[model samples]
Target: MDFLTLDYFIKLFNIILIDLVLAGDNAIVIALAARNLPKEHQKKAIIWGTVGAVIIRIAATLAVVWLLQLPFLLLIGGVLLVWIAYKLLVDEKEHNIEAKPQLWPAIRTIIIADAVMGFDNVIAVAGAAHGSFDLVIIGLIVSVPIMVWGSTLFIRLVEKFPVIITIGAGVLAYTAGSMLTGDPFVKGWFDENPVMKWAFIAIVVIGVILAGYLKKLSKNFISINEQGQLTIPDSIKNEAQIEANDSFEAKVDDQGRIVLVKVAKSEG
Candidate 1:
């Protein structure tokens, strides 16, 4: 259990890596929240907002560490993480523009958004830190600047290559599944059935991917009928190469807003 060992360093590296990858949304939040302020106040807002986020993360990670010590809490957290991943994949409204032209409001929005959206990051980082508060703090310290300064670049990359978002979500799912299997409540069962760990991870990863795929499928065009029911637009069905008799499944986003209307795959 030497803190200076290579294994410990690897864990620390993992914490940093997770922070960098999964923190893109927070960066976007900071940027958008502060973008509406006066030009002179923009930089100040970003700096102070990042500082605020880091402080919040520290408190959140500390709380998660304590909560994780209890039985079954990790399992609950894992479920929440999985849901977060699913939402990340399906929800398309990540970009929120602000035109308030005010300073304090922008800064306030930044902090509030960070607080609301930070659970996924805090839990993922806490899991990667492996219960080391020092590791968590150091990891956040090292990665927050990259997110704050490099946010525009990261956002461009994510937009150009949407796979990055999927990858980030997958990472969250993997962390969540790992936490579930490693939770004290189920740790003994997993120890006795060693294969269960890999099985759990596989299920989580595949489930996430499949859910995302289905969400994508829902992007097909549909018409809202007089009764408020969804129906495939005849022209769109022909364009989509879908058969007339094909069924569709509507997918709702995290906020219960329907995003897409997709034709159900026919059973052979």
Candidate 2:
């Protein structure tokens, strides 16, 4: 495809989407790993970990792209893509956000987890690129930090609008289907019957949506406890509490009476 052509743009767009979706989990892992450190250490850990993650991700993606050029490797990649897409759509929610690690430990954990989990990212990007190096690199450069910094926001948005997750999952499944069709083992089949290739793509996309919808329905019936100190059930209520705290103060009257009261911080 010509670099400036519509096909190129579409390919780049899909790469960006894959990067955005897969990258968020890695970013969250980094943030959570660093969250328990001393404030200063936490900042350092995030910065250094992000830098390390970027370098590792870039290297891994390049390696995967190179390997993908081999005959039949695309079939492996395509199967991996489908697995990743399914996991993204149906994986259980991560309830254990890791405590902040010590400086060296946090960095180590971040690097190790990212190195292992990052293959999903690399394969997804490679599939999206359809073997275009420039497009893959550009997509990574643009989407990585957005995925990192904006992950918390993305998580909140997913909670607020659950359909976004379903749509994102469907996109990944579509990308997976495309990857499968492009595989050397499948290429001839796809070429001979383009309708079959399109049918597979439709099945993947629809299957993801149906699965997500059913999961969403089941989740609705599984009632989460609405009362918890750590759980913020409503953003408005949470913001109101924060504002109240920002303006709060203890006041003393002439008789030494305490006029304003708030929950006292506990010494853990």
Candidate 3:
């Protein structure tokens, strides 16, 4: 119980290390959930969402022992995680960013996903802490900054290379499958039948990825009509904040590429 002992510091370091490694999935969920929001509000969502998720983690870590005893806890959580991964993947769009996105839903997603996905972290940290609540508190305190930085970094990465979202979803699905296999009720069976465990994991991961890809690809097709005049699709226009009768200046650049810029209205 001594705060300054080497053992205390070692345990704290272990807790921090565990959290750092486990934080990637939480960061991805935050990024994917907030990316569709306006740039100004994305920061708010990231910060608030992370705070809520951390609070949930703390509470879960505290009750993790008892929570583990609850029947079907891992099974139910794994199913929910699979659904969340699928939802996050399919809901993302190239031109479907909302001008007025709901903040709470994104925060809610972050909290629920983090809580479900955090069981590993909680158990890992709890084992490291050796029942020391003080270590738990300090460890979570140190993790907040790391979690925020991770979320922002992922958001930028997703902006540049969107495949990360799919990868992230696969990661979630894999974790979910692992959770399912580890559930107490099923763990005995899975241990006796390891091949079935691998099959279940493969099915969950591939099914989520394929279903999300197909759903995302099902966006409405938009094309110019035969009149030679291009009309903007409502979804694209709304995403771009283009109003009816909006004027655009088109130019052919040195690369022989066409570019369009919206013209600002003049004051009377």
Candidate 4:
């Protein structure tokens, strides 16, 4: 395995950008949630929360790396990642999670929020990593501090230079293309037709950018009750075919982009 190739560096760089853009949001949420705690507890909450979140991220990325090895899953994951990249540009949902009053509560909030809000982050990183556990580990390790302490600096940087996001999304699109190339069913065909292979990747990268610009950003903001219980619109529930006891997986990032996906009945 020659690791000095330009392709390797591109993937590594993609992982770095993905981590930089996606990691900071989690950090901001932790800081805001921990701010309500006492000084000593705040310190502990930040420390433990960072550790717990990083650990879970590591596990999740590893799981994705393994899953991508399955036949045709790489192709599916790549398509999903393309949508995720597009959503990274336009999907902004807010999670009105309450900051806890106590130390454990605050820490728990940070961890839970990280886990919930981290769905895209995890999948994006895994896609960029391209089954390289080294890249995955490096990405997570490099991102931990950013997610824990560098939220404001990154937030400011992104605000000042919004193009940075486009660059990151492009990198994600490249990885998505790579996934399709690596798909077991298509690998041989692409290997025989290198020109067509590059063409497909270039198309995926260009298509994501065009779609991202042409589509409007969707707004899905749901408010929580005093107890942090969310009230879904009856219309939404009906459209989604949600049952009275349906469960959801909810996450909120620093930018306050909240996502709520209904879980399967068995999983619920």
**lDDT for position 164 in model 2:** 68
Model 3 vs. true fold: TM: 0.51
Which of candidates 1 and 3 is the stronger one according to TM-score?
Answer: 1
Residues 78-182 of candidate 4 have per-residue lDDT tens digits of: 888888878767654455667788998888888888888888777788877877898888767876776568778887888899888788788888888988898
In angstroms, how far off is 104's CA in candidate 2? Answer: 2.9
Between 1 and 4, whose lDDT is larger? Answer: 4
How high is the lDDT of residue 123 in model 3?
A: 61
Off by over 4 Å in 1: 1-10, 95-105, 221-268
Q: Look at candidate 4 and give me any clashing residue pairs.
A: 93-257, 93-258, 94-258
Give the lowest summed-lDDT range of ten residues in model 2.
228-237
lDDT of every model, 2 decimals: 0.77, 0.74, 0.72, 0.80
The predictions' CA RMSDs to the true structure, in order, are 9.8, 10.7, 10.2, 12.9
Candidate no. 1 TM-score: 0.74
Q: What is the descending lDDT order?
A: 4, 1, 2, 3
Candidate 1: RMSD to truth: 9.8
